[model samples]
Target: MWPIGRSFSSQNLFLCLVICQVVVCMLFVIYRNTQSLEHRLAILTSRWAAREDGFDFPEGPWNVTDSDVVRCSDLINGRFPSEAAINRTIDAIRETVIKDYEFIELTRDCTKFAWERGYYNKPITKEELDFPLAYTILMYRSVHQVEQLLRTIYRPQNIYCIHIDSKSPPLVHIGMERISRCFDNVFIASNLENVYWGTINIVKAERHCQKDLLNRTDVSNWKYLINLTGQEFPLKTNLEIVQILKEFKGQNDIRTLAQPVEEWTYYRHVLEGDTIRQTTLLKTEPPPDKVPVHKGPFFSALARQFVEFLQSDIADKWLEWFNDTKNADESFTQTLASYPNAPGGPGPIGSKAIISRDIVWSSERLRERRPCYGKFVRRVCVHSWRDLVRVSKSIRLFANKFHVEYDGLVLQCLEEAIHNKTHNPPMLTFHFIDDFSSSE
Candidate 1:
């Protein structure tokens, strides 16, 4: 009996040992799995933390911040689109395109495939985006198209201006109305005065536009002006334009003509000599607030303060001169803006100015008023696919006259140019706020 009991005890001890070994193995596995999961969680947390901060990005004309604007301008010049760009664009589309919505939106609306189908192969550099505006004018007499074009480019803020001669058809007014419907940030000339080629009318109209700009207090809040005509179109997508401008906003010197009124006289008169003759006439009444005198170009992005100056009392003499003078169109704004120490503060404000003077002049030398020396006579037409491609490459925010029927073409071109690759490249660096990881 003692031997049997001893055997049972030994057997029981062996069973207990086996059970303990199994438990140990299972515990080891559980511990390892928990450690592995913890490591994975830590890694994910670290990655998220890094992203909360930004990666180093390329500098200039790019920002993740919301409040930024970009400014670039080109005179209307008709240059065709590039083949390689079209192909790459189409390739990207094919890779991403799916479903009927994509077909209509990406293919039909954008017209990216049309160019890849070998429509025309004109090379367009970033520097050569001046043609669409010229073509839009020659084809369409509509001044409202300029506003549409500005919409395609992305800027934190935007203002568009359109200038039409008194000679422009009644449809011009209709076009202006159409523009008003589409864009709220546009300025259309309220006074439709006759613009004799060599007479003061052109300058008068320009002054009127400037006066409107100067009168506004809100316009100054903007960082840039597009100064476009009805015929111009955008080459870069709004996203791209916004990105580029955001990167370069404060850094670039492309502010509109917002120089203080006092500076205008000094630089224009003493330094540039754009104005040789200045007639100083004292106003007996000291006219109520300054009249807007000849400012350059119907379409310009004036700085807010500069515009205010144009509306100030200092601009009174200049405006009086513009309204009364005959050949003032030729030199009124230029002269008054440049006169040294003229009563007004230096006038033309802004970092740079681009003048678009592509109009066909008749053989009749402008004997009646000051002659326009360099006006391209051939009217512009943007009917064909080639025309659309060419105009899209212009990269100008504003353009001139387009026929009413060409609105579809203009809109299409504008949309495509905005979406192009070169216009919106990825930023080199990224940024994140501190405590992003710690809080999580």
Candidate 2:
């Protein structure tokens, strides 16, 4: 009986030992899982914090804060900050949040304020008193940029025709209409075109604006017609532009290249269908028009006589011939400028006198001197703040491809510079005359 009792006690002790080992293993696993969960939670919290702070983000133009406005005002008033200081501020806000809805509402409110306050109304000086310049602005986006451009170049005597791309967002159309209604000199184009790059639609859009401007009987004071894009900013003041135009003395500034039509010009596009559209490139024969083919940049400033010629039968014939031609915008105007007997043709003034735009092509030389702000699209460089010094010193009346989102400082400084020049006209010194002559 004593031996049996001892065996039962031994078995009970072994069972207790096994149960203790199992409990210890289970506790270790629970502790490790808790630690892992805490680590995961910490990582998620850090990610959210980074996003909220806008770290590592490029600043957007519409992200202007009250402090930024104060700084800009200071700069305009000649409290110039060092380049490094400016860059630091810009970098700090580079990743500022962008809300599309807020941007649209801001545009509407600003337009209303400008209209009520007459912010753009200014007295015309003798230099531009009688000389009216016509402008056609082709815009697809950037409502704020457009408004800034209008305010900067505003003159009661000048007429502006804005053509919003038919494919643009509804907000863009609404903003443009509201802004145009504010001034008698500004009007939206009745005929809007769906513009495609390197397509005839661009030329058609310009022609529509020109025709609308010419048909308006309410205003008859315009003398020169300058075509512009939304990305272009005027480097010269209105008075300066007027003086330069007067120097031309009735000649047009249209660049042209007298050369045979390249093979690439023969490429054509075929649309798949009306609703679900797909474009297919097809190589076609050279333009049927027997006239010599010429190529040039799309932008120009033409005299009223030349603009009228574009509305004549001869211009219509060239337009029809180039309807199917690829990259017609580059050739249509050039062909007209090179045509015999045309107002801006190879006449007494010569084609060089007609060339005015300061376009920076994406050549090896340009890449070496001035690096592009953003990636090149279609081989064109988008101007950034880095190019501000070079562009400001340029002799051209206007520069192309400035994006507010890319670098707001360039445009901001440019506006201040222009305003300063206007308010305090420079003295007429011999050096000024020499600089003016060299620019011409």
Candidate 3:
């Protein structure tokens, strides 16, 4: 009887220990979860604060930045300062404009000259630093064609920060300088660095543009920012473009596009199918270390709010996911932007959401000719002038793939077609022809 009693007590003690351990684990988990939730909430608050005020400026959204004030000042001082003056006067009611925000619309050469003579090496911070303004940056290697488009097609109303790589020699800079002279709005960065292929140098160069813009927020009034390659040409006039953008105003839809998982897989298998084997592909598992996941470079845009989203903790988690993966730029942005449960939720899909445009190519065709330029252009350009006339009537924007030599005719024809009185406000006028057209 004694022996049996002792055994029962021992078993009870063992069960108690197990229960205690389980309870302790549960407590630890709860505490950790609470801590995590608090951290997330703090980050959300900071992001919201940053969004309301520009990044690094802690004031309310109503608090105006110095750079914004400068552009407004420049606009007020300009020939067409009515709108600019009104906007500036309204902003000045809140606070005086900072110096960095002042528009250096004098001339690209003059600005570059000033920069070379130690103008902006040290950024203006909020304290001793002026309210750093975001500069709007435009990057492209091929400028000759872009210059032609800017000169002949549509000149942007706002001054733009333009950079061409140093490899093109003094002639490119000279050409850009000439362009700058004609339009005070185009400022060229003279200190061009050699961009090494397949390295982060290109990315860093772009970031430099972003940093410059971020540092000097006064010159830029853009709530949404676009990163355009020199190859990218705008199909619409500035008035029409602004009109279309006005529709999306107030509604913050930060756009960051990514190839869908299926699309990513398609690229991966198409590139690696022969070596990867059918059986391995059929396994339906995550890619092994031996196989690289495929991703492509993107031409993307982001709203100011979306940029804040990138700075948030949510983006850190996203970075960790793609840190080791190749072609992470494509994967990270797309996945985070599309992830349903992500903070701030999924971003707008693409130009389709803004206005319908075709960019499709068959897998077989793409395989036969990787990155078909003419086909891409023809997707919108169509055959003959008649086809373009019919198609342009429906589509707001169109892009072409042919060399400038081949595609120049298409552009001229497009400009002429839109100029026709019958075209009504031009084909570009229909961009975002929704309920909001009357507002402009």
For all candidates in order, the CA lDDT equals 0.37, 0.67, 0.39
Sorted on TM-score, best first, the list reads 2, 3, 1
TM-score of 2: 0.71
TM-score of each: 0.40, 0.71, 0.45
RMSD of each: 18.6, 26.8, 25.0
**lDDT score, candidate 3, position 337:** 49
- In model 1, the worst 10-residue window by lDDT is 130-139
- Let me know the TM-score candidate 3 reaches against the reference structure: 0.45
- Model 3 poorest ten-residue lDDT run: 43-52
Candidate 2 lDDT at 281 equals: 58
Best by lDDT: 2
lDDT tens per residue, model 1, 154-174: 232344445566666666555
Q: Order the numbered candidates by lDDT, best leading.
A: 2, 3, 1
Error of 1 at 142 (Å): 2.4
Of candidates 3 and 2, the better by TM-score:
2
Residue 296 Cα positional deviation in candidate 3, in Å, after optimal superposition: 8.6
Best by TM-score: 2
